[model samples]
Target: MKKTTSFVSIGTIILLLFIHGCSGCKKEAQNLSDSPKKTFIGPFMNEDSILLYVQKQLECGPRNPGSNGHSSCKEFLINFLKTKADTAFLQTFSSMVYGRTYEMSNIVASFSPDKKDRILLCAHWDSRPFADEDETPSKRTLPILGANDGASGVAVLLEMARTLSISKPNIGIDIILFDGEDLGLSGDLNGFFQGSRFASKNYPLPKPKYGILLDLVGDKQAEFRYEPLSQQAHFVLVDNIWSIAKERGSPYFIHETGNSVSDDHVMLNEQGIRTINIIDVNLVGNISTNPRRTYWHTSRDILDNLSMQTMSDVGNVLLDFLFTTSDSVY
Candidate 1:
C-alpha cells in the first residue's frame, strides 16, 4: 500500500511538470507569432526622421535655382549625403535655363560602389521659381516653398540613405539629388530635366540595373498613380511596384495610370537607364482655386500640406521592394 501511494504521488508530480513545460511552450510560440517576422529585410522607416528632413529643407527657404536658398540647400544636401553614403560624387556642371547660365550640381551617393550590380534612385531637389498655379496673379510671380514638391522626395531618399547606412543589402544602390529640374516652362520639355540630362550625358560610370524617381510624394492626400511613361519604359517594373504596394496594404499607391509627367525620369530613360517616375499627379489646380493636392508650383505647397504618413507609406513600399523581393528588380 505504501509503495502504491508513493508511485501515484511521483506520477502526479511528473504530470504537473509536463503540463507546466507545455504551457511555457505555448506562451513562447504566441510571443513569436506576435513579433514581426525577420524574413522582411527592410529597415523600419522612421517617419519622424523623414519629417525632420522635410522641415530642414523648407527652413532653407524656397530653393529656386540661383537664389540664396538654393545655394544653402545645396550645401546642406551635399553635407548630409556625405554623412550617409559610402561614396559621394558631386557632378558639377554649367547649364543654361531661361537664357541664363546657372551652375548646377547633381549629388550622387552610392552604397557598395565597388559592386557592378547597382540600382539608382533619384529626385529633383530644386523648387519651382514661379507660383504660376497660384490663385492670385500677383502671387504667381513669387517662388514656392516646395515642402511637398521638392523636399518630400529628397526627404524620402535621405531616410533611405539612413537605412542603407545601417543594414545595407547585397546590392549596390546609388542616390542622386538632381538640380535645375524644376526651372523650365510647362510647354517646353527641352529646358526641364537639365540636371538629369547632364547626368545622363555624362553618366558617372555604368548605369544601375534600373532606377526610380520620386516627385510630389508628400501630400496629405498623396496618391501615386503609375505614370504612363514608366509603363512604356518598363511595364513589368511598374507592375512589380504596384503589386508590392498592394501586397503591403499601402493605402495610397493606387493601381491606376497617372497623367504623363515630363519629369527627370524622362532624361534617364532617354539615356537608356530604364528609370521610372513615381509622382502624385492628382494635383488638379484651376486658374484660381487649389484642390487638396493640386498645389503644384504654388506658394500653397507648404510644410503643413505634407503628411508623415504619406511619406512613410511610399518609403516603406520602396524598401520592401528592394529588400524583400525574391529576385532582382532588373
Candidate 2:
C-alpha cells in the first residue's frame, strides 16, 4: 500500500509538471509568432545621452529659415559638428518663397573622410514656419518647435557623429542636417525637400552609394513602415533595415510596408542616387491629432511630447547599419 501511494504521488507530480510546460509553450508560441513586433540593442541604449541635446534645439525657439534663432542655431551646429567630424561645411543657397528670396543653409558633417565609399544620412533641421495642421488659423502662421518632426532626426545623426567620431566606422558617413524641408505650399507642389535638392545638385563629395533620410521619428509609439517608393527603389536597403529592426525588438519598427511619402529622399532618387526615406508613417485614424500627430506643424510640437524611447529605437537601427555596412557595397 505504501508503494502504491508513492507511485500515485509521483504520477500526480508528473501530470502537474506536464501541464505547466504545455502552458508555457503555448504562451511562448503566441508571443513569438506575433507580427509588428519591436526590438532594441546595445547601440540604442546609448541614444539616451542625446535626447537632451535635441530638446535644447527646441528650446532655442523656432529655427525658421530667416530668423535670429535659425542664424544662432547654425553657428551652434557648425561648432558642434566640427568637434565630431573630420570636416564640416555649410551649403548656402537662395530660394524665392512668396516672391521673397530666402537664404537657406544646409549643414553637412563628414566622418571617415579618407574612405572613398560613403553613405549619406540626412534630416531637415528647420522647423516649419506655419502650423497649418493646427485647428486655429491664427496659430497656423506661427513657427513650430519641431521636437519630433525636425529635432528627432537631427538628434539621431548628432549622436551618430558623436559615436562614430571616436569609434570610426569602416564606411564613410555624411550626416547632412538639411534645412527648409517643411516650408512649402500646395500651389507649387515642388516646394518641399529643398536641402536635399541642393545637396544632390551640388554634392561636393562623390555621390554617396546610398542615402537614408529620417523624418518625424519621435512618436511615443512610432511605427517605421517601408515607404512604397523606397520598396521599389532600394528594396535591399529596406529589407536589411527591417531585418535589423526585427532582431532589435523595438516596438515601433513595423514589418509591413506603408504608404509612399514624397520626402527628402525623392530628390536624391531623382539625382540618380539610391535613396530611401525612413519616415514615421503611422498616420492612421485618430492615433494622433491628425491621426499621426495632426499637431505636426503646430506650436504644440514641444519637447514634453517627445519620447526618448522612439529616438533610441531609430538610433539603434541606424548605428547598427552604419557600423555593420560593408565598404564594398558603395
Candidate 3:
C-alpha cells in the first residue's frame, strides 16, 4: 500500500540540474508593528470560488498535458487570468514523455509588469495520469482529479489576482501556472519540472528576485512543514511567512520541517531564483513522517478531501505578506 507513497520527488530530481545558476534585490523587510497595512481582510475570502473552479477542471476530465481535457482546461485558465492580470500569455513548448513527443503550455500572468521589484507565486496545473499512490492496483491506471494537489493552489492565486486587480499591491507579482510537473517518469530525473525548467531557462524579460510555489495546500488537515530546499535557499523569506501564519492563528501552517519534497521550486532555485515551496505534508503526530501522510497522490485527492479553513488561512497569510511590504522589493 505504501509503495505508491515512495514515488520519486520532483525536488530531488531537479536538484541535479541545480548546477546551472546565476542572482537578489535589496528590499527592506518590515515588521508587523512598522507596517500597519499588513492587516488583511478575510471578508473577500471565497474558498467556494476556488472549489467551483476545481470542479470545472474536473468536469473537463483529467488534465494530462496531451489530453483533450488539458487543452480545454488551459483555455479556461488563460481566459480567467486575462480578467485578472495586467498581462497574460500562454507559453507553448514541447516535451518528450516515454519516448513520445507532446506539447505543453505554461500559463503566465503578470501584475504591474513595469515594476522592477517583483515576486513570483506559482503552482502546477497538470493532473497526474496515474494514481500511482492509490492502495488498490486496479486504481493505479485511473486518472486523479487533483482537486487539492493541482487546482487548490492555482485557485488561491487566481483569487489573489482578482483581489489585486481591485486593490493594487506595492510590488509586482507574477503568478505562473506550470505544466508537465506530474509527468516525471519513474527514475528519470530530467523529465520532471518541465514547465518550471523551461520558464527559468527562458524567463520573460525582468525576472523576479524571489518566488513562492504552492502545492497540495487544501487538505482538511493541511499542515505546511518548511520544505528543506526552500528553507536552505531562502530562510529569511520562509521565516517571515511562517511568522505571519503563526501570528494569524492559522492551524494549517506548521513550523516544523516535513519530509523533503521535489516540486517546481527546485527549478527556480537552480536558476538562481530564491524560491520557497509551501506544501502540506504531515510531519506531526506520533506516526512516522518518513513516508508521510496516507492520502497523498491517491484517488482520494478530491474536493471532499480539502478544507476551506485551510485555504483561507493560506490566502490570508499571503495577503499579509504582500501588505506588510511597504517597500517594492520583497
TM-score of each: 0.85, 0.84, 0.83
Residues forming the 10-long window of minimal summed lDDT in candidate 2: 35-44
Question: After superposition, which runs of candidate 3 have C-alpha atoms over 4 Å from their true positions?
Answer: 1-44, 283-293, 326-330
In model 1, where do residues sit more than 4 Å from their true spots?
1-41, 284-290
lDDT by residue for model 3 over 192-282, one digit each (tens)?
7889999989886488889999988887777788888989988878887887787677877788887777779999899998899998755
Q: Model 3 Cα displacement at 15 (Å)?
A: 45
Residue 173 local lDDT, model 3: 86
| Candidate topping lDDT | 1
**Ranking of candidates on lDDT, top first:** 1, 3, 2
lDDT of 2 by residue, 1-330 (tens): 234336646765765676677985755545444433323233443656667678668767789889887888888787899998999989899887677677999999988888888898888999878777677888977888888778888888888788777776678888898888877864454677788788888886767889888898887767788899887778888877776677667778888978887788888898888888888865421244444365566767777667888887787787766666434333
lDDT, candidate 2, at 278: 86
Error of 2 at 43 (Å): 4.9
Better of 1 and 3 by TM-score: 1
Candidate order, TM-score descending: 1, 2, 3
Error of 1 at 22 (Å): 34
Question: Could you tell me which residue pairs clash in candidate 2?
Answer: 38-249, 38-250, 38-251, 39-248, 39-249, 39-250, 40-248, 288-291, 290-294
Error of 2 at 50 (Å): 1.8
lDDT of each: 0.82, 0.77, 0.77
